[model samples]
Structures are given as C-alpha cells and as structure tokens.
Target: MKLFADYHTHTIYSHGTGTIMDNVNAAKKKGLKEIAITDHGLRHFTYGVKREKLKRMREEIDEINENNKDFKVLLGLECNIISSDGQIDLDDEAMKYMDIVLLGYHMMVRLKGVPSYVHIYGRHYLSKISKSMAEETRQSNTDIMINAIKKYKVNIITHPGARISMDTGRLAEAAAKTGTALEINSKSNIMTVDYLKVAAGHGAKFVINSDAHKPEDVGNFRNAIKLAEMAGLTSHQIINAVKS
Candidate 1:
C-alpha cells in the first residue's frame, strides 16, 4: 500500500535527530504529498517543545512550504494525554498553529491533579495491583483518550495501548465515533495483529505513519504496512493512503 502523507513525524525540537527542513526534504524525496513536524507538547518534562517555540516552528514551516510547493510541511503537535479527565496541554492559542493534533500517553509529562497522577504514575504496576484496581486504571486511561477525541479535533491517536494500560477496543470505537483515525505507527509495538483486528472490527479508520525521528526514516511505513497486512486491512481503510 502506498502512503500519500505522513502527519506524525518529529524533528530536533522534540529529541528527534533531524531538523524541520530535513524532514520536509526527506518527504519530498520519498514522493509524499504532505508531512507534519509534530513535536511533543510543552508539558513533557525532558524533550517537550516550549510554548514559545511553536511560533518559530510555524515560521520555519511557512518558509519551507512557501518555496517548496511540491510538498506540504504542516505544523502539528504530538500532544500528551495528561489526565484521566482527558485534559491535554493543547489550548485555543496552540490550535491556531496546528493542522493536525496527535494524542498519545507519554511517561515524562508533568503530572498534576489526581487524574494525571493516577494514570501517569499509578499505571506502572498494573499487573501487581489488585484486579479491580487494574481494571479501573485501564478503563480510566481508555476514557481519557476517548474524551480527548471528543474534546479536541484530534486527527490521530498515536500508538494505542503502547506504554499505558487501556482497553483498546473501546478506545478504537470512540475514535471511530469521533471521526478520529487510529494510527499504525512504525515505531510503537502496540500495532500488533490483534490490536489491528480489534480496532478494525470496530470500524476505526487508520492512518499509517513512520513516527520518524530522523530525516532518513521519514516516509518509511514498512512496519505499519506489515501490521496492516497481518490484520487484513485494505488500503482504503487507511486514510493517508487514500487518493485525494
């Protein structure tokens, strides 16, 4: 299956190895029509892009895309799903610069309030905890993402069931209901056959992305395609693969 766009790549802004222009150039070389530089949110402790940095990032994107009409380089964020209430760091001001918003659970986000504390820190020993507690935490995380989709115009949910505990089936259904696409990421291990099977059964549309941190890795969707094939996913089911 061929990909038309990759809207979930990273650059030096968020611990990535390449620059914004480097990612765009790589996408051009690979014949992709579009790409987005989705840095981590400001709440991420170690590698998050600061709030002020987003304006400069948008400037760079505008400059690059102005001269390079053949490829579109979008400005976006891989926003952290911070609270069980589905409160992320994305705000109205930030949305002005974003063409796509990718949501995922990350361990390094600054946790505040009881909901964030429980899901971000409390989910570590899910297996060791009581069965009821584990189930509660899982449902909470799942609802967080579900509510995130409803609360925000999220384009994709990256790497579902990767590092956090969640009920993937329910998450998939919520995403589908909200017109959000579930991602088949190149780097995350959660895009397994069974995960795709469950998601697809819920009628979730999918987007395949490299999740590339380096320029060279930019349009590489080998792993994503393999998983899709394993789950018997048609190219039509993949949003990014569709001809516009």
Candidate 2:
C-alpha cells in the first residue's frame, strides 16, 4: 500500500471534541504513516489553541512519537487570517514551536459581510473574490503566508478557499515561487475543479488534507483524490508529509 498521511487535523487542545490520544490511536488504526495536529490558531473567537495548550500538545506529540515509532506525528497550526489585509492571527513568538503553519480565512474572523467580489459572482463561488481593500488583506495573507514559508520554512498552506478568497492564479504563482504546497482540503467544501486545474496548470505543488476533527475522520482522503485526478495531478505533484 502507498504510505498514507493526513496533515490537517485538530485535537482537544483545539476544542476539537477529540483527545490528542484519540487522534493518534485513530492514525494507528487507519495505518497512516503520519498525521499532523493542526489545531486552530489563537485567533479563533471562541476556541483556539493558546500558548499553554500548544505546549501541552507538543509534549503529548513528543510522547506519541516516542511510543508510536511506526508513525510520524507533526505539530502544526491552522492559523486564522485575522483581517482582509491577510495578517495571520498568531504573533511571531507563538509560531516558533510549530512544524507547519497553514493559513485560512474564517467567516467569523475575516469578513464582516460578503465582499463585493463574492457577492457579484454569487456567494457560493469558492474562488477568492474580494474588494480592493480586501486585496490588501489577500495580499497581506499572500505575503504573510509566503513570508512564513520563507521565515519558518513551513511545508504547506491549508485550504486557500474557505471563507476568504484570493486570485488562484496569483496564489499558484506565489506557491510556485515559494516552493510551498497548497492544500485540497476534503473536510471543507471541496476545492473547485476549475481552481485545481488552474493550479496544476501553473506547476504548483499540492497537499491533500482531511481537516479532520475526529479520529474516524483521519484518513478520509477520498474527495481530495477525486479533485486531484480531476485536476490531472500525478503523484509527483503531491507533497505528502510522510513522503520525500
């Protein structure tokens, strides 16, 4: 069997309704080579990973790593894009301990209302559509995301098209330039086929993620694979965390 891995997941520290041990146990049962615990960054209005929780999560991951030598566990953050200007919620100090930092825009955090671009295109459109000011946010996100990769050398960016939007072409361009991978998140609404095709067309690398909140959800990569094949992604184009 191909080595399976899921790089976007949450634990109880995230208020994710599951324990860290539950996630690890799930990974073991699913036969995954690795699972990344990427709980929401500190900006989540109601439930976010605070410094203390992150420390504890790391300690837990360390213990899991020692015990479960058969599997690799990654510590990560699904940092919220706090504003349209694209600034991530975590400060420099908070990001130091993380293995990966994935950025996303949340409705509760990023937008006050549907931006004009989304409104004009229809609210359901998954591609990034933002006002000029929102571009600052998008650009800020782009810059911040790119800079995080440069600064911390984080491996991947989480779902690019959640509540926030960006120009896929530009994002692909950035991903290519930065050597970072963009995610096809299965747990969120599937990445639009058009966006996937456009991204692959640009030679951007990709990551398939479940964004799993529960242990049972860990290795569910079905929708992600469908989008990948639809986009004509080959194994070489995917950046699986467990693989080289």
- Number of the predicted model whose lDDT against the real structure is largest: 1
List the candidate 1 regions with Cα displacement exceeding 4 Å: 126-132
Writing each residue's lDDT as its tens digit, candidate 2 over 5-95 gives: 8888887877676887888788778777888899887867666777777777888888889997788888888876443334566677777
Give the Å shift of residue 39 in candidate 2: 0.5
Q: Which ten residues in a row have the lowest lDDT in candidate 1?
A: 119-128
Q: Write the per-residue lDDT of candidate 1 for residues 40-151, one digit (tens) a residue.
A: 9878999899889889999999999889767788898999977767888898998899988998888878866876686557765664467767777778778878888899
Candidate 2, run of 10 with poorest lDDT: 119-128
Any runs in candidate 2 off by more than 4 Å, and if so which? 1-3, 83-85, 110-154, 241-244
**lDDT score of model 1?**
0.86
lDDT of each: 0.86, 0.71
Q: Which pairs of residues clash in candidate 2, taking residues 3 or more apart in a chain or in different chains?
A: 84-137, 85-137, 86-137, 86-141, 128-165, 128-166
Q: Give the deviation of candidate 2 from the true structure as CA RMSD.
A: 5.1
Q: After superposition, how far is residue 200 of candidate 1 from its true place, in Å?
A: 1.3
Clashes of each: 0, 6
Scored by lDDT, model 2 comes in at 0.71
lDDT of residue 69 for candidate 2: 73
